[model samples]
Target: MSWFIYALKNYLNFSDRARRKEYWMFFLFYMIFVFVFAFLDTALGKANSMEEALDLEGLFSPIYAIAMLIPSIAVTVRRLHDTNRSGWWILISLVPVIGILVLVFFTVLNSDEGFNRFGRSPKAEPAF
Candidate 1:
């Protein structure tokens, strides 16, 4: 999907606004890939137990996760920016359950109309 590729291309860009569709589509595809890799690992006997599966102890899945880690954070930060929140808000997820719930609430919110401070809304059409 274009959205997934867009996120990957901007993998290190944490200073822009990302539309909700972009963020969610990347997330959807990322999870799908993780599952696919995990299945391959199990089929190849790289992961032999439920614990290993849960721990993602496999060649493909772990490698994929490592490769995508920065992109995931970047997109999440950009998603927060779209909502007009500071990227530092991502640290809120460090507080366990409440923090994660709060972060989810923030990410699911609609982008601020026009712009507050981060930049133009990703949902806005460019003027010609």
Candidate 2:
């Protein structure tokens, strides 16, 4: 999906606001790809054991996480913006435990009815 491509291309870009379409598109691609790969990997029986399969999975995790970083941050910022909160609040995730949950809650929360400071609105269709 477009979001996946955008995320891969903008892996290092953490600024700017991302609309829901972009964020969800990337999420959709990620889930589908991960699931398909996992299913095939299992069917192939390439690794001798589950642990080996897990180790193999680990090798790609860094790349996958890197691919996901930009959209994650961008979307999170926009979500924060929706709540009339500064994007800087994303930094709160640096805290030990509670911070992670709080930040996740905010980013995963649906956007407000209208725009705040980020942009017009998330309702517009992306130019795919």
Candidate 3:
């Protein structure tokens, strides 16, 4: 839970490194919220079709996603920084299935031990 908040607190911070736990935990909670909101939309809201269910009037998922967009991008960029890669690496996901798989591979890997161009290792910092 703290990890999720930490991610949000640094929602605009894309200029540093994010340890593996930070990146994954944020994503985990984000996906959980997305699922919960989708469930609420379907069970509590009126919608005759799938399109309507995703429309602005039907569910909280869209709103939640919009709210999370920046934090999500920030974390991903920082995760790439942790791997000693540029934030532009995120655009690799535009290639297709292969691109997304590559980005996932990079994000799941552990951070660089010391530092690169981005900043000091998040792992080297003391845990709060």
Q: Please give, for residues 92-116, the per-residue lDDT of candidate 1 as tens digits.
A: 9999999999999999999999976
What TM-score would you give candidate 1 relative to the actual structure?
Answer: 0.93
- Local distance difference test, each candidate: 0.89, 0.62, 0.86
lDDT of 3 at 78: 95
Per-residue lDDT of candidate 3, residues 96-116 (tens digit):
999999999999888888968
| Winning model by lDDT | 1
Give TM-scores for every candidate, taking all chains together and pairing residue i with residue i: 0.93, 0.58, 0.89
Question: How many clashing residue pairs, candidate 3?
Answer: 0
* Per-residue C-alpha lDDT of model 2 across residues 39-104, encoded as one tens digit per residue: 555566654444544445543433555655666676666557765678889899999899999986
Q: Using TM-score, give the best candidate's number.
A: 1
What candidate 3 gets wrong by more than 4 Å, as runs, is 48-57
lDDT comparison, 1 vs 3, better candidate: 1
Which model, 2 or 3, shows the larger TM-score? Answer: 3
lDDT of 2: 0.62
Compute the lDDT for candidate 3. Answer: 0.86
lDDT ranking, high to low: 1, 3, 2
How far does residue 60 in candidate 2 sit from its true spot (Å)? 2.5
Query: What is residue 20's positional error in candidate 3, in angstroms?
Result: 0.6
Better of 1 and 2 by TM-score: 1
